[model samples]
Target: MARSSAGPAVAGLTAGALAIVGFLAFQASATAPDHPTQARGDSHSSAPGNGGKKKSPSSTKVPADSGTGRRVVYQLESRRVWLVGADERTIRTYPVAPSSVDPDPGAYAVTSRNMSLVGSDGVQVEHVIVFHQEDGIVFGFSAALDGSLPNPKARKKTGAVRQTRPDGKALWDFALIDTKVVVVR
Candidate 1:
Protein backbone atom coordinates (compact mmCIF):
# COMPACT_ATOMS: atom_id res chain seq x y z
CA MET A 1 0.00 0.00 0.00
CA ALA A 2 1.23 3.48 -0.88
CA ARG A 3 0.34 6.66 1.04
CA SER A 4 -0.97 9.52 -1.12
CA SER A 5 1.16 12.70 -1.07
CA ALA A 6 -1.71 15.02 -2.17
CA GLY A 7 -2.91 15.77 1.37
CA PRO A 8 0.37 17.26 2.57
CA ALA A 9 0.96 19.14 -0.70
CA VAL A 10 -2.48 20.82 -0.58
CA ALA A 11 -2.01 21.77 3.06
CA GLY A 12 1.42 23.26 2.36
CA LEU A 13 0.17 25.28 -0.62
CA THR A 14 -2.78 26.63 1.35
CA ALA A 15 -0.53 27.72 4.18
CA GLY A 16 1.82 29.51 1.79
CA ALA A 17 -1.05 31.36 0.10
CA LEU A 18 -2.49 32.48 3.43
CA ALA A 19 0.95 33.69 4.54
CA ILE A 20 1.27 35.87 1.44
CA VAL A 21 -2.21 37.35 1.95
CA GLY A 22 -1.42 38.13 5.58
CA PHE A 23 1.83 39.86 4.63
CA LEU A 24 0.11 42.04 2.03
CA ALA A 25 -2.63 42.95 4.49
CA PHE A 26 -0.04 44.01 7.05
CA GLN A 27 1.79 46.20 4.55
CA ALA A 28 -1.41 47.97 3.49
CA SER A 29 -2.41 48.74 7.07
CA ALA A 30 1.08 49.92 8.00
CA THR A 31 1.18 52.43 5.15
CA ALA A 32 -2.38 53.74 5.45
CA PRO A 33 -2.67 57.22 7.00
CA ASP A 34 -4.21 57.49 10.46
CA HIS A 35 -7.08 59.80 9.62
CA PRO A 36 -9.65 60.43 12.32
CA THR A 37 -13.04 58.96 11.46
CA GLN A 38 -14.85 61.96 12.92
CA ALA A 39 -14.25 65.55 11.80
CA ARG A 40 -12.91 67.71 14.65
CA GLY A 41 -12.75 71.50 14.92
CA ASP A 42 -9.20 72.83 14.68
CA SER A 43 -9.71 75.12 17.67
CA HIS A 44 -12.02 77.24 15.54
CA SER A 45 -15.19 78.84 16.86
CA SER A 46 -17.55 76.06 17.85
CA ALA A 47 -20.55 78.26 17.24
CA PRO A 48 -21.65 80.14 14.14
CA GLY A 49 -21.03 83.89 14.54
CA ASN A 50 -23.55 86.76 14.55
CA GLY A 51 -26.30 84.91 16.30
CA GLY A 52 -26.34 82.12 13.77
CA LYS A 53 -26.35 84.48 10.84
CA LYS A 54 -24.52 83.70 7.66
CA LYS A 55 -20.82 84.57 7.61
CA SER A 56 -18.99 86.14 4.72
CA PRO A 57 -16.54 84.22 2.63
CA SER A 58 -13.75 86.39 4.04
CA SER A 59 -14.58 85.09 7.50
CA THR A 60 -13.07 81.77 8.42
CA LYS A 61 -16.31 80.38 9.76
CA VAL A 62 -18.96 77.93 8.64
CA PRO A 63 -22.16 79.48 7.32
CA ALA A 64 -24.70 79.90 10.11
CA ASP A 65 -27.63 78.82 7.97
CA SER A 66 -26.09 75.41 7.32
CA GLY A 67 -28.50 73.93 9.80
CA THR A 68 -27.63 72.40 13.17
CA GLY A 69 -25.64 69.33 14.14
CA ARG A 70 -23.06 67.51 11.99
CA ARG A 71 -23.20 68.17 8.23
CA VAL A 72 -21.26 68.93 5.09
CA VAL A 73 -21.55 72.59 4.08
CA TYR A 74 -21.02 73.69 0.48
CA GLN A 75 -20.91 77.37 -0.36
CA LEU A 76 -21.41 77.87 -4.08
CA GLU A 77 -20.06 81.37 -4.45
CA SER A 78 -17.02 80.94 -2.21
CA ARG A 79 -15.99 77.69 -3.82
CA ARG A 80 -15.46 76.32 -0.31
CA VAL A 81 -16.70 73.30 1.57
CA TRP A 82 -16.87 72.85 5.34
CA LEU A 83 -17.09 69.68 7.36
CA VAL A 84 -19.09 70.45 10.47
CA GLY A 85 -19.10 68.38 13.61
CA ALA A 86 -21.99 67.32 15.81
CA ASP A 87 -21.64 70.43 17.98
CA GLU A 88 -22.09 72.72 14.93
CA ARG A 89 -18.34 73.37 14.87
CA THR A 90 -16.30 73.81 11.73
CA ILE A 91 -14.11 70.77 11.54
CA ARG A 92 -12.47 71.48 8.21
CA THR A 93 -12.86 73.83 5.25
CA TYR A 94 -11.12 74.03 1.89
CA PRO A 95 -11.51 75.54 -1.54
CA VAL A 96 -12.86 73.49 -4.41
CA ALA A 97 -13.05 73.92 -8.17
CA PRO A 98 -16.72 74.35 -8.88
CA SER A 99 -18.23 72.62 -11.85
CA SER A 100 -19.79 74.55 -14.66
CA VAL A 101 -23.25 73.61 -13.49
CA ASP A 102 -24.28 74.57 -9.99
CA PRO A 103 -26.87 73.21 -7.62
CA ASP A 104 -29.36 75.58 -6.08
CA PRO A 105 -28.52 76.81 -2.61
CA GLY A 106 -30.46 74.44 -0.42
CA ALA A 107 -30.27 71.31 1.67
CA TYR A 108 -29.44 67.92 0.28
CA ALA A 109 -28.28 64.55 1.55
CA VAL A 110 -25.55 62.23 0.38
CA THR A 111 -27.55 59.89 -1.79
CA SER A 112 -24.81 57.71 -3.25
CA ARG A 113 -21.07 57.18 -3.32
CA ASN A 114 -18.59 55.63 -5.71
CA MET A 115 -15.01 54.99 -4.70
CA SER A 116 -13.72 55.36 -8.25
CA LEU A 117 -15.27 56.05 -11.61
CA VAL A 118 -15.00 57.90 -14.89
CA GLY A 119 -16.75 61.19 -14.29
CA SER A 120 -19.12 62.86 -16.73
CA ASP A 121 -16.34 65.23 -17.70
CA GLY A 122 -14.20 62.24 -18.71
CA VAL A 123 -11.84 62.44 -15.73
CA GLN A 124 -10.84 59.61 -13.45
CA VAL A 125 -12.40 60.57 -10.14
CA GLU A 126 -12.52 58.99 -6.72
CA HIS A 127 -14.47 59.25 -3.49
CA VAL A 128 -17.55 60.53 -5.30
CA ILE A 129 -20.30 61.81 -2.98
CA VAL A 130 -23.43 62.64 -4.91
CA PHE A 131 -26.05 64.75 -3.18
CA HIS A 132 -28.42 66.52 -5.54
CA GLN A 133 -29.91 66.51 -9.01
CA GLU A 134 -32.22 68.75 -11.00
CA ASP A 135 -33.40 68.96 -14.58
CA GLY A 136 -31.31 65.92 -15.49
CA ILE A 137 -28.14 67.40 -13.98
CA VAL A 138 -26.45 65.58 -11.09
CA PHE A 139 -24.40 67.27 -8.36
CA GLY A 140 -21.52 65.54 -6.66
CA PHE A 141 -18.11 65.94 -5.08
CA SER A 142 -15.02 64.10 -6.27
CA ALA A 143 -11.25 64.29 -6.52
CA ALA A 144 -9.53 63.65 -9.77
CA LEU A 145 -7.05 60.80 -9.77
CA ASP A 146 -4.44 62.93 -11.55
CA GLY A 147 -5.18 65.93 -9.32
CA SER A 148 -6.41 67.91 -12.26
CA LEU A 149 -9.43 70.19 -12.28
CA PRO A 150 -11.85 70.42 -15.13
CA ASN A 151 -10.79 72.82 -17.83
CA PRO A 152 -12.26 76.24 -17.21
CA LYS A 153 -12.77 76.83 -20.91
CA ALA A 154 -14.64 73.62 -21.55
CA ARG A 155 -18.33 74.05 -22.11
CA LYS A 156 -19.29 70.77 -20.44
CA LYS A 157 -21.86 71.18 -17.72
CA THR A 158 -20.40 68.74 -15.23
CA GLY A 159 -21.49 69.00 -11.63
CA ALA A 160 -18.42 67.52 -10.00
CA VAL A 161 -17.00 69.87 -7.36
CA ARG A 162 -13.35 68.91 -7.54
CA GLN A 163 -11.27 68.64 -4.38
CA THR A 164 -7.76 67.60 -3.44
CA ARG A 165 -7.24 63.93 -2.76
CA PRO A 166 -6.78 64.35 0.98
CA ASP A 167 -9.90 66.47 1.22
CA GLY A 168 -11.82 63.92 -0.79
CA LYS A 169 -10.77 61.17 1.58
CA ALA A 170 -11.75 63.22 4.58
CA LEU A 171 -15.16 63.95 3.07
CA TRP A 172 -15.52 60.32 2.16
CA ASP A 173 -15.01 59.31 5.77
CA PHE A 174 -17.26 61.99 7.20
CA ALA A 175 -20.18 62.00 4.76
CA LEU A 176 -21.81 58.64 4.55
CA ILE A 177 -25.14 57.99 2.84
CA ASP A 178 -27.95 60.18 4.16
CA THR A 179 -25.45 62.67 5.60
CA LYS A 180 -26.86 66.18 5.47
CA VAL A 181 -25.36 68.59 2.95
CA VAL A 182 -26.22 72.28 3.22
CA VAL A 183 -25.53 74.55 0.25
CA VAL A 184 -25.44 78.28 0.77
CA ARG A 185 -24.76 81.26 -1.42
Candidate 2:
Protein backbone atom coordinates (compact mmCIF):
# COMPACT_ATOMS: atom_id res chain seq x y z
CA MET A 1 0.00 0.00 0.00
CA ALA A 2 2.80 2.46 0.88
CA ARG A 3 4.67 1.68 -2.37
CA SER A 4 1.61 2.50 -4.44
CA SER A 5 1.14 5.82 -2.63
CA ALA A 6 4.79 6.72 -3.10
CA GLY A 7 4.79 6.20 -6.88
CA PRO A 8 2.69 9.22 -7.74
CA ALA A 9 4.47 11.30 -5.10
CA VAL A 10 7.86 10.42 -6.59
CA ALA A 11 6.63 11.19 -10.12
CA GLY A 12 5.28 14.51 -8.95
CA LEU A 13 8.55 15.43 -7.29
CA THR A 14 10.52 14.53 -10.39
CA ALA A 15 8.27 16.65 -12.55
CA GLY A 16 8.62 19.59 -10.19
CA ALA A 17 12.39 19.31 -10.20
CA LEU A 18 12.50 19.12 -13.97
CA ALA A 19 10.34 22.21 -14.26
CA ILE A 20 12.57 24.22 -11.93
CA VAL A 21 15.74 23.21 -13.73
CA GLY A 22 14.17 23.89 -17.09
CA PHE A 23 13.09 27.34 -16.07
CA LEU A 24 16.50 28.28 -14.70
CA ALA A 25 18.18 27.01 -17.83
CA PHE A 26 15.74 28.99 -19.91
CA GLN A 27 16.36 32.13 -17.87
CA ALA A 28 20.11 31.82 -18.43
CA SER A 29 19.56 31.40 -22.17
CA ALA A 30 16.96 34.17 -22.49
CA THR A 31 19.31 36.56 -20.71
CA ALA A 32 22.34 35.61 -22.81
CA PRO A 33 23.07 36.03 -26.52
CA ASP A 34 24.03 32.47 -27.40
CA HIS A 35 21.95 29.48 -26.36
CA PRO A 36 20.25 28.93 -29.73
CA THR A 37 17.43 31.51 -29.25
CA GLN A 38 15.01 28.82 -28.19
CA ALA A 39 13.17 31.24 -25.94
CA ARG A 40 12.25 34.93 -26.26
CA GLY A 41 13.22 37.77 -23.93
CA ASP A 42 11.86 41.25 -23.49
CA SER A 43 15.33 42.72 -22.94
CA HIS A 44 17.07 44.47 -25.82
CA SER A 45 20.46 42.86 -25.27
CA SER A 46 22.29 41.44 -22.33
CA ALA A 47 25.41 43.04 -23.83
CA PRO A 48 25.68 46.04 -21.56
CA GLY A 49 25.35 49.58 -23.05
CA ASN A 50 24.44 48.49 -26.61
CA GLY A 51 20.80 47.79 -25.64
CA GLY A 52 20.53 46.13 -29.05
CA LYS A 53 19.32 42.54 -28.97
CA LYS A 54 20.70 40.63 -31.92
CA LYS A 55 19.36 37.36 -33.22
CA SER A 56 21.08 34.13 -32.22
CA PRO A 57 23.54 32.62 -34.69
CA SER A 58 22.88 29.20 -36.13
CA SER A 59 24.80 26.24 -34.68
CA THR A 60 25.77 25.28 -38.23
CA LYS A 61 28.47 27.53 -39.61
CA VAL A 62 28.04 28.34 -43.29
CA PRO A 63 31.48 28.89 -44.81
CA ALA A 64 32.11 31.99 -46.93
CA ASP A 65 31.88 31.69 -50.69
CA SER A 66 35.04 32.92 -52.46
CA GLY A 67 35.85 36.64 -52.11
CA THR A 68 32.28 37.51 -51.37
CA GLY A 69 33.55 39.53 -48.41
CA ARG A 70 30.48 38.85 -46.26
CA ARG A 71 27.26 37.44 -47.59
CA VAL A 72 24.15 37.49 -45.46
CA VAL A 73 21.83 34.59 -46.03
CA TYR A 74 18.76 32.95 -44.49
CA GLN A 75 18.54 30.25 -41.85
CA LEU A 76 15.92 27.55 -41.72
CA GLU A 77 14.73 29.33 -38.59
CA SER A 78 13.08 32.48 -39.86
CA ARG A 79 13.22 34.44 -36.62
CA ARG A 80 17.05 34.11 -36.60
CA VAL A 81 19.45 33.96 -39.53
CA TRP A 82 23.12 34.77 -40.16
CA LEU A 83 25.72 37.23 -41.37
CA VAL A 84 28.62 34.87 -42.09
CA GLY A 85 32.10 36.16 -42.89
CA ALA A 86 35.66 34.82 -42.96
CA ASP A 87 35.61 35.51 -39.25
CA GLU A 88 33.02 33.53 -37.28
CA ARG A 89 32.99 36.11 -34.47
CA THR A 90 31.55 38.74 -36.84
CA ILE A 91 28.09 37.17 -37.16
CA ARG A 92 24.96 39.30 -36.83
CA THR A 93 21.27 38.78 -36.07
CA TYR A 94 17.93 40.07 -37.42
CA PRO A 95 14.19 39.42 -37.24
CA VAL A 96 12.16 36.85 -39.11
CA ALA A 97 8.54 36.47 -40.08
CA PRO A 98 6.54 34.95 -37.23
CA SER A 99 5.81 31.29 -37.67
CA SER A 100 2.38 30.12 -38.79
CA VAL A 101 2.39 27.71 -35.86
CA ASP A 102 -0.10 28.25 -33.09
CA PRO A 103 0.26 28.48 -29.24
CA ASP A 104 3.97 29.30 -29.92
CA PRO A 105 5.87 30.79 -32.89
CA GLY A 106 9.30 30.43 -34.60
CA ALA A 107 11.73 31.70 -37.33
CA TYR A 108 13.24 30.40 -40.58
CA ALA A 109 16.32 30.86 -42.78
CA VAL A 110 15.69 33.25 -45.71
CA THR A 111 17.38 31.08 -48.33
CA SER A 112 15.33 27.98 -47.67
CA ARG A 113 12.13 29.93 -47.08
CA ASN A 114 12.39 31.63 -50.46
CA MET A 115 12.95 28.34 -52.21
CA SER A 116 10.07 26.71 -50.40
CA LEU A 117 7.78 29.60 -51.22
CA VAL A 118 8.72 29.49 -54.89
CA GLY A 119 8.06 25.78 -54.98
CA SER A 120 4.95 26.26 -52.92
CA ASP A 121 3.54 28.45 -55.71
CA GLY A 122 0.81 29.49 -53.29
CA VAL A 123 -0.06 25.85 -52.79
CA GLN A 124 -0.04 26.33 -49.02
CA VAL A 125 1.08 28.93 -46.52
CA GLU A 126 3.19 26.55 -44.38
CA HIS A 127 5.80 23.81 -44.76
CA VAL A 128 6.80 20.79 -42.66
CA ILE A 129 10.29 19.64 -41.62
CA VAL A 130 11.98 17.72 -38.83
CA PHE A 131 15.14 18.24 -36.68
CA HIS A 132 16.92 15.60 -34.63
CA GLN A 133 18.78 15.94 -31.36
CA GLU A 134 19.73 14.10 -28.21
CA ASP A 135 20.38 15.33 -24.64
CA GLY A 136 18.68 18.62 -25.62
CA ILE A 137 21.55 19.74 -27.87
CA VAL A 138 20.52 19.97 -31.52
CA PHE A 139 23.00 18.20 -33.87
CA GLY A 140 21.69 19.70 -37.13
CA PHE A 141 18.83 19.43 -39.59
CA SER A 142 17.10 16.11 -39.90
CA ALA A 143 15.33 14.59 -42.93
CA ALA A 144 12.23 13.81 -40.89
CA LEU A 145 9.19 16.03 -40.21
CA ASP A 146 7.39 16.10 -36.82
CA GLY A 147 3.78 17.32 -36.97
CA SER A 148 2.62 15.89 -33.69
CA LEU A 149 3.37 18.97 -31.62
CA PRO A 150 0.83 21.67 -30.90
CA ASN A 151 1.85 23.29 -34.17
CA PRO A 152 0.94 21.16 -37.14
CA LYS A 153 3.67 22.79 -39.23
CA ALA A 154 6.59 24.64 -37.67
CA ARG A 155 8.79 26.90 -39.80
CA LYS A 156 11.12 28.30 -37.16
CA LYS A 157 14.74 27.68 -38.24
CA THR A 158 16.95 27.73 -35.17
CA GLY A 159 16.36 25.47 -32.20
CA ALA A 160 12.98 24.73 -33.73
CA VAL A 161 12.55 21.27 -32.27
CA ARG A 162 13.51 21.32 -28.62
CA GLN A 163 13.69 18.27 -26.41
CA THR A 164 12.87 18.30 -22.74
CA ARG A 165 15.73 20.09 -21.03
CA PRO A 166 17.03 20.84 -17.54
CA ASP A 167 16.34 24.57 -17.88
CA GLY A 168 12.84 25.88 -18.44
CA LYS A 169 12.15 22.98 -20.76
CA ALA A 170 12.33 25.43 -23.64
CA LEU A 171 12.87 23.95 -27.10
CA TRP A 172 12.73 25.11 -30.72
CA ASP A 173 11.52 22.64 -33.32
CA PHE A 174 11.23 23.14 -37.08
CA ALA A 175 8.08 21.47 -38.26
CA LEU A 176 6.38 22.83 -41.38
CA ILE A 177 9.39 23.96 -43.41
CA ASP A 178 11.83 21.99 -45.54
CA THR A 179 15.48 22.94 -44.99
CA LYS A 180 18.97 22.25 -46.38
CA VAL A 181 22.51 23.35 -45.56
CA VAL A 182 24.12 24.92 -48.60
CA VAL A 183 26.53 27.73 -49.40
CA VAL A 184 24.33 30.43 -50.90
CA ARG A 185 27.18 32.84 -51.37
Candidate 3:
Protein backbone atom coordinates (compact mmCIF):
# COMPACT_ATOMS: atom_id res chain seq x y z
CA MET A 1 0.00 0.00 0.00
CA ALA A 2 2.81 2.42 0.88
CA ARG A 3 4.70 1.70 -2.41
CA SER A 4 1.58 2.31 -4.53
CA SER A 5 0.87 5.61 -2.81
CA ALA A 6 4.51 6.77 -3.32
CA GLY A 7 4.30 5.98 -7.03
CA PRO A 8 1.32 8.33 -7.52
CA ALA A 9 3.01 11.13 -5.56
CA VAL A 10 6.18 10.85 -7.64
CA ALA A 11 4.23 10.99 -10.85
CA GLY A 12 2.36 14.09 -9.72
CA LEU A 13 5.59 15.90 -8.88
CA THR A 14 7.16 15.00 -12.19
CA ALA A 15 4.17 16.29 -14.12
CA GLY A 16 4.26 19.56 -12.19
CA ALA A 17 7.95 20.04 -12.96
CA LEU A 18 7.35 19.42 -16.65
CA ALA A 19 4.57 22.00 -16.72
CA ILE A 20 6.80 24.64 -15.15
CA VAL A 21 9.58 23.97 -17.64
CA GLY A 22 7.22 24.27 -20.57
CA PHE A 23 5.91 27.59 -19.34
CA LEU A 24 9.39 29.02 -18.95
CA ALA A 25 10.36 27.91 -22.46
CA PHE A 26 7.33 29.62 -23.90
CA GLN A 27 8.19 32.83 -22.09
CA ALA A 28 11.73 32.84 -23.44
CA SER A 29 10.68 32.33 -27.04
CA ALA A 30 7.98 34.96 -26.77
CA THR A 31 10.50 37.61 -25.75
CA ALA A 32 13.15 36.76 -28.31
CA PRO A 33 13.95 39.27 -31.08
CA ASP A 34 12.62 38.40 -34.50
CA HIS A 35 14.59 38.28 -37.75
CA PRO A 36 13.26 40.52 -40.53
CA THR A 37 12.41 37.61 -42.83
CA GLN A 38 10.44 36.00 -40.05
CA ALA A 39 8.02 38.91 -40.04
CA ARG A 40 6.72 38.06 -43.51
CA GLY A 41 7.79 34.43 -43.48
CA ASP A 42 9.58 34.99 -46.79
CA SER A 43 11.90 32.17 -47.80
CA HIS A 44 13.32 33.65 -50.98
CA SER A 45 16.90 32.57 -51.55
CA SER A 46 19.81 34.93 -52.03
CA ALA A 47 21.53 35.53 -55.35
CA PRO A 48 23.83 32.66 -56.46
CA GLY A 49 26.81 35.01 -56.72
CA ASN A 50 26.37 36.56 -53.27
CA GLY A 51 27.87 33.62 -51.32
CA GLY A 52 24.53 32.79 -49.66
CA LYS A 53 24.33 35.96 -47.59
CA LYS A 54 20.71 36.99 -47.24
CA LYS A 55 19.74 40.58 -48.02
CA SER A 56 17.97 42.42 -45.22
CA PRO A 57 14.58 43.95 -45.78
CA SER A 58 15.95 47.27 -44.51
CA SER A 59 17.80 47.63 -47.79
CA THR A 60 14.52 48.23 -49.59
CA LYS A 61 13.88 51.75 -50.87
CA VAL A 62 11.81 54.13 -48.77
CA PRO A 63 8.36 54.93 -49.99
CA ALA A 64 7.65 58.21 -51.76
CA ASP A 65 6.39 61.13 -49.66
CA SER A 66 7.64 59.67 -46.40
CA GLY A 67 8.29 63.29 -45.40
CA THR A 68 11.48 65.20 -44.65
CA GLY A 69 13.24 65.82 -41.36
CA ARG A 70 13.58 63.65 -38.27
CA ARG A 71 10.08 62.34 -37.98
CA VAL A 72 7.97 59.21 -37.90
CA VAL A 73 6.03 58.81 -41.12
CA TYR A 74 3.07 56.43 -41.10
CA GLN A 75 2.03 55.62 -44.64
CA LEU A 76 -1.51 54.40 -44.46
CA GLU A 77 -1.77 53.06 -47.98
CA SER A 78 1.47 51.08 -47.76
CA ARG A 79 0.96 50.02 -44.15
CA ARG A 80 4.57 51.01 -43.46
CA VAL A 81 6.41 53.36 -41.14
CA TRP A 82 9.67 55.23 -41.78
CA LEU A 83 11.91 56.86 -39.26
CA VAL A 84 13.54 59.68 -41.17
CA GLY A 85 16.65 61.38 -39.98
CA ALA A 86 17.09 65.15 -39.80
CA ASP A 87 19.19 64.97 -43.00
CA GLU A 88 16.15 63.67 -44.93
CA ARG A 89 17.43 60.11 -45.08
CA THR A 90 15.62 57.06 -43.88
CA ILE A 91 17.13 55.70 -40.69
CA ARG A 92 14.84 52.69 -40.78
CA THR A 93 11.62 51.57 -42.39
CA TYR A 94 9.48 48.54 -41.66
CA PRO A 95 6.10 47.11 -42.41
CA VAL A 96 3.34 47.34 -39.79
CA ALA A 97 -0.03 45.69 -39.44
CA PRO A 98 -2.37 48.59 -38.75
CA SER A 99 -5.80 48.40 -37.25
CA SER A 100 -8.96 48.89 -39.26
CA VAL A 101 -9.35 52.41 -37.91
CA ASP A 102 -6.57 54.69 -39.15
CA PRO A 103 -5.87 58.23 -38.09
CA ASP A 104 -6.60 60.79 -40.75
CA PRO A 105 -3.70 61.86 -42.97
CA GLY A 106 -2.09 64.69 -41.06
CA ALA A 107 0.71 65.62 -38.75
CA TYR A 108 0.74 64.58 -35.10
CA ALA A 109 3.17 64.13 -32.26
CA VAL A 110 4.07 61.35 -29.88
CA THR A 111 1.83 62.05 -26.95
CA SER A 112 2.90 59.20 -24.74
CA ARG A 113 5.09 56.12 -24.61
CA ASN A 114 5.19 52.95 -22.57
CA MET A 115 8.00 50.44 -22.28
CA SER A 116 5.79 47.43 -21.85
CA LEU A 117 2.13 46.66 -21.58
CA VAL A 118 -0.64 44.18 -22.30
CA GLY A 119 -2.27 45.62 -25.39
CA SER A 120 -6.01 45.78 -25.98
CA ASP A 121 -5.68 42.65 -28.10
CA GLY A 122 -4.27 40.80 -25.07
CA VAL A 123 -0.75 40.57 -26.55
CA GLN A 124 2.40 41.47 -24.67
CA VAL A 125 3.83 44.54 -26.46
CA GLU A 126 6.81 46.78 -25.98
CA HIS A 127 7.97 50.21 -27.15
CA VAL A 128 4.52 51.66 -27.42
CA ILE A 129 4.36 55.10 -29.10
CA VAL A 130 0.97 56.68 -28.74
CA PHE A 131 0.35 59.46 -31.25
CA HIS A 132 -3.36 59.82 -31.78
CA GLN A 133 -6.71 58.97 -30.28
CA GLU A 134 -10.25 59.28 -31.53
CA ASP A 135 -13.71 58.48 -30.23
CA GLY A 136 -12.27 56.77 -27.14
CA ILE A 137 -9.93 54.66 -29.27
CA VAL A 138 -6.20 55.13 -28.74
CA PHE A 139 -3.87 54.78 -31.71
CA GLY A 140 -0.20 53.99 -31.52
CA PHE A 141 2.65 51.82 -32.70
CA SER A 142 3.95 48.74 -30.90
CA ALA A 143 5.51 45.35 -31.46
CA ALA A 144 4.64 42.10 -29.77
CA LEU A 145 7.39 40.64 -27.67
CA ASP A 146 6.62 37.28 -29.26
CA GLY A 147 7.02 38.68 -32.80
CA SER A 148 3.49 37.67 -33.70
CA LEU A 149 0.84 39.92 -35.26
CA PRO A 150 -2.50 38.33 -34.71
CA ASN A 151 -5.42 39.74 -36.59
CA PRO A 152 -7.43 42.26 -34.60
CA LYS A 153 -11.02 41.55 -33.67
CA ALA A 154 -13.36 42.81 -36.38
CA ARG A 155 -15.79 44.28 -33.89
CA LYS A 156 -13.16 46.08 -31.80
CA LYS A 157 -11.58 49.39 -32.71
CA THR A 158 -7.81 49.11 -32.30
CA GLY A 159 -5.18 51.55 -33.54
CA ALA A 160 -2.13 49.61 -32.56
CA VAL A 161 0.30 49.27 -35.46
CA ARG A 162 2.26 46.12 -34.81
CA GLN A 163 5.91 45.79 -35.85
CA THR A 164 8.68 43.28 -35.20
CA ARG A 165 10.56 43.29 -31.91
CA PRO A 166 13.69 44.95 -33.32
CA ASP A 167 11.72 47.61 -35.10
CA GLY A 168 9.76 48.27 -31.93
CA LYS A 169 12.94 48.86 -30.00
CA ALA A 170 14.18 51.25 -32.66
CA LEU A 171 10.94 53.18 -32.63
CA TRP A 172 11.00 53.45 -28.85
CA ASP A 173 14.52 54.86 -28.98
CA PHE A 174 13.87 57.29 -31.83
CA ALA A 175 10.41 58.53 -30.95
CA LEU A 176 10.42 60.72 -27.89
CA ILE A 177 7.62 62.69 -26.39
CA ASP A 178 6.56 65.43 -28.83
CA THR A 179 8.35 63.74 -31.75
CA LYS A 180 6.58 64.62 -34.95
CA VAL A 181 4.52 61.90 -36.62
CA VAL A 182 3.48 62.49 -40.22
CA VAL A 183 0.62 60.43 -41.56
CA VAL A 184 0.46 60.34 -45.34
CA ARG A 185 -2.11 58.73 -47.51
Q: Could you tell me how far off, in angstroms, the CA of residue 11 lies in candidate 1 after the best superposition?
A: 57
Model 2, position 64, has a per-residue lDDT of 39
TM-score of each: 0.69, 0.28, 0.67
Give the top-scoring candidate (TM-score).
Answer: 1
Assess the local accuracy of residue 88 in candidate 3 as a C-alpha lDDT between 0 and 100.
68
Model 1 C-alpha lDDT per residue in residues 1-185, reported as the tens digit of each score: 99786998999888767745643453344211112322443523223345843332335477777788889999987777888889876677767777788899899999999999999888789999999988777899998876667554568777889887878998999899999999999
User: Whole-model Cα lDDT per candidate?
Assistant: 0.76, 0.31, 0.73
Give the clashing residue pairs of candidate 1, or none: none
Per-residue alpha-carbon lDDT of candidate 2 for residues 64-135, written as tens digits (9 for 90 to 100): 331233333334343233344444443433322222331122222222221122111122222322333334
Q: Please give the range of 10 consecutive residues that has the lowest summed lDDT in model 2.
A: 141-150
What TM-score does prediction 1 earn? 0.69
Give stretches of model 2 more than 4 Å off.
1-4, 34-46, 50-128, 131-176, 181-185
Tell how far residue 24 is off in model 1, in angstroms. 33
As a whole number from 0 to 100, the lDDT of residue 8 in candidate 3 is 84
How many residue-pair clashes does candidate 3 contain? 0
Model 3 residue 35 CA deviation (Å) reads 7.9
